[model samples]
Target: MAICNQSQFKPISISPKTNHLSNFNLQISRSQTLLKCHNNNTSSLPTKTLKIEPLPLFTSVRSFAPATVANLGPGFDFLGCAVDGIGDYVTLNVDPEVQPGQISISDINGVGNSGKLSKNPLWNCAGIAAISVMRMLGVQSVGLSISLEKGLPLGSGLGSSAASAAAAAVAVNEMFGGVLSESELVLAGLESEAKVSGYHADNVAPAIMGGFVLIRSYDPLDIIQLRFPMEKELFFVLVNPDFEAPTKKMRAVLPSEIAMSDHIWNSSQAGSLVAAVLQGDLRGLGKALSSDRIVEPKRAPLIPGMGAVKNAAIGAGAFGCTISGAGPTAVAVTDNEQKGRDIGEKMVEAFWREGNLKATATVRSLDRVGARLISSNS
Candidate 1:
């Protein structure tokens, strides 16, 4: 993880912005008034609504969590957004017959190298996350069995480990009757991420909470859900080179201390980006997204053809382009789907032309729903 300058942390200052809040509040008030009128006119009304029973304790539960793009250029280890269509699925089953406090990895598939993974709970991201959730919830007697289905490539800078950890945490929480809140589940996922990557919620927070998330502070683990312009047609272009950029290696290349001017510039850019997103200023957002002076300059050299790829993406009509997380993957933002696709293809072509590396590119929307239970069997 890149070290952030905490002394420069400041609130984003923006003018008051209009959203759908007034319309939503108006609709709620009208509905309440109509309900009151109906009750006054009716002789009798049912006071009790139908009660839906909760499902019985399930032996197994399956969940899926979307891939996330962290940093977003300037907000290192703080800002993240969940991307649609690519993610990881995990199934966690309770084994009552097994010894207490035991976790087993029954199966792993989809990103290759299943045989290379360790079965121990302490080693595997999904297993460790599931076990952490169970322990946090005080479910001591139930043993856990985890199965991971990787939809995203490992070490591709697409929050692959975070997705698995988040899915496992959500699956285990669902199997245990959904006792854990979203924040608690995020913390469980963070535990696994800490073991594998580093103790940062930039990826895990959005993977669990969905959409855009800002990690305000790590001391108290403050996560704020930021609103995106849902009315606008925003798309993401993801280009992944056929190579791996290990998170540790990426972090190792970054300087331990940054210049004060660089820190202030990054802070201002990040704040502007957040404010633009909140204000629905797409043009301002694009400028802010493209302005990253600190991390990207140091990390771009590590990724082959990163400079050309970003230039191609911008030339093809993307709002901005930057390293997705640690790199080997580059992300571009656009308002039109066709433009996003074009940007993706251009990025892939640039990667091949510049570095002779074959890459894959895809355009996807933002995933608003984060980790969710896809299936369950009691």
Candidate 2:
């Protein structure tokens, strides 16, 4: 949904000063309450025994797509949501005779074949999903292969890689007679998250399953999937500065101990944002989205003219503007595409005027549909 309305909204209070990060030990206690919320609900169906009837050992190709956003506003590593516009598609095929634990990249095309996926297990979303699927099913000798069609930009904070992991997991599960439950797949995606940036599923979970998801805790796999209220139009103007910020570097820059006051401020803002979305208060939602007190300030400086771009977007009637992902890329939310386009133009103009650099911005509607299985071929 559009985070802000073009004419009706204005940025209320914004601090342009760079945040002074404190170096201290910050231990975020895992809250299993998030998980309990999902499992304890009476509406949820009880786990059913698998009615396995093996038809054939032949190969079947399936596709899965996931929406993702890491470092969503105040939560940093903890908060992420799957937007509709961007994601990854994975086509998986199972070959029973190929032996279990065997994975071959028969034909790697498009987004993930830069040899980067081959380097580290974490960076390769496909690899992580494969590992998780195998581990979960206790399969040791089934051969498999995956093809990825990546629609999202890599390193744009769009959960491009996480989409691959979610897609691969879903596709693999379907190929295996849907043995892995939805929760199991979510857990698998979270496990794969460790390959890239520690372990978290704020992005992957929602990407696998549509709608707004709250990751209350990661350990013991506590994932809460909540349905976002309908009647909201969440549009995204994703502006890529074509600059890359390492996720690890951004993590390192985070303040270990935030002031209790700042923490409260962020908490209120987050809560308000959530409420705004639920209430279908587009104006309020926009205001809340831009009112991030935690990471944006500390991280904006890394993007050359982020400050100017943000100001320009605000000037151009954007609800709020902030860096997308770790940035170089930024986002401006508006009620309509035209406003988003105008804001994007202003953002690029601001970058040029202030940083003497060129930037690109693409506008899209918020994707309510997370990931889906496109096809299965025998």
Candidate 3:
């Protein structure tokens, strides 16, 4: 289904000077005076110029992007949170010998079917994102090889593709002297995600920016990084069933249009969720999360024993339970780490006993750090 439109909600104003990075340190922010001859009259005007700096020739660069959970129930594509412990790592190697503007996939590990992954840049998420980063920086030519180590399961509703894309974009941007801004890197990741799934930034935003992200608007690209409560301890339980919920298929099953009543309900829940998060009201946040009236209802039938699993989690003292992304994976929240573990195991057991599906569960705290460079070799 199409994500909820931001126009439906009241506009949320945010400052541009927030902690999020905007431009690379090397990128020129000053305007240069240029002389223009108009109608035989010389006129002096300021023009923007993107200054390119020569970067150190690095042999290899490695980066990591954390896994994320999008939708978060009521907010759909507008909301997302990063998960710790699981993510994707990408290593980019410059191949000056090869033709510029070409990217080759040298190796892929972690995710299954390595042979199935295309070597062509356009077909690969990491390669495409890296190439997009190069294009964004006005780099006409670049030749590189990429290696992916997928830590998250494919189609696990864990933002696997986004992690790969974010890691690749960050690595490529870093290798090129970090010219792209944080938002620009998200755009690069979106380019890759568009090719793989649909063009949406819910997963990409949090994967690159960390914490909780509210995609206020797609046009003009307004992304707000919500402050997560560091004072309050929060835990998450992620249960992955032995089945893939391909995004395309899940989207296809959703209704093309939602009722106005449902829209209003969802918008209310979404607003409440944002407020609860900011106020550190875990109980209210959990209620808002489980109160989706639109997408989940339509999609729940696709997942076997989803109702039972959710019930088990809630019964086990989870704040709430909901499907993560386009799920076959379900996520639950809790304040206590031990309770979170119990919820996770209970959810997994429900999937197996009730749904007759084998699954695994993990308990993780939120990852505040998004994507970053791990190591680089010159």
Q: Which structure among the candidates has the greatest lDDT?
A: 3
lDDT of 2 by residue, 50-134 (tens): 2111221237666757556555566555555666656677777775545566665544456432444553443477777866776
TM-score each candidate.
0.84, 0.79, 0.88
What does candidate 3's lDDT look like per residue over 1-378, in tens digits?
A: 111111111222333443323233324232111111112111322233222432434679999999999999998988998988789999998888657756777888886434456667788888889888876554435578888998887788889889999999999877766655678788888889899988888999899988888988866678888777899877779998988788899999989898999999999999999998888788987898899999888887899978899999999988888999999889899888888888988998999888899989899888888999999998
Give the C-alpha lDDT of model 3: 0.79
Clashing pairs in 3: 101-142
Model 1 — which ten-residue stretch has the worst lDDT? 1-10
What would the per-residue lDDT of candidate 1 be over residues 9-84, giving only the tens digit for each residue?
A: 1222211222323433343344332211111212332333211112226878889999999999998889999998
Ordering by TM-score: 3, 1, 2
Arrange candidates, best lDDT first.
3, 1, 2
Please identify which of the two predictions, 1 or 2, would achieve the higher TM-score against the true structure.
1
Candidate 3: Cα lDDT at 292: 95
Which ten residues in a row are the worst by lDDT in model 3? 1-10
Stretches of candidate 1 exceeding 4 Å from the true structure: 1-56, 112-115
Better of 1 and 3 by TM-score: 3
Evaluate residue 11 in candidate 3 and report its C-alpha lDDT on the 0 to 100 scale: 26
Q: Which residue window of length 10 is worst by lDDT in model 2? A: 20-29
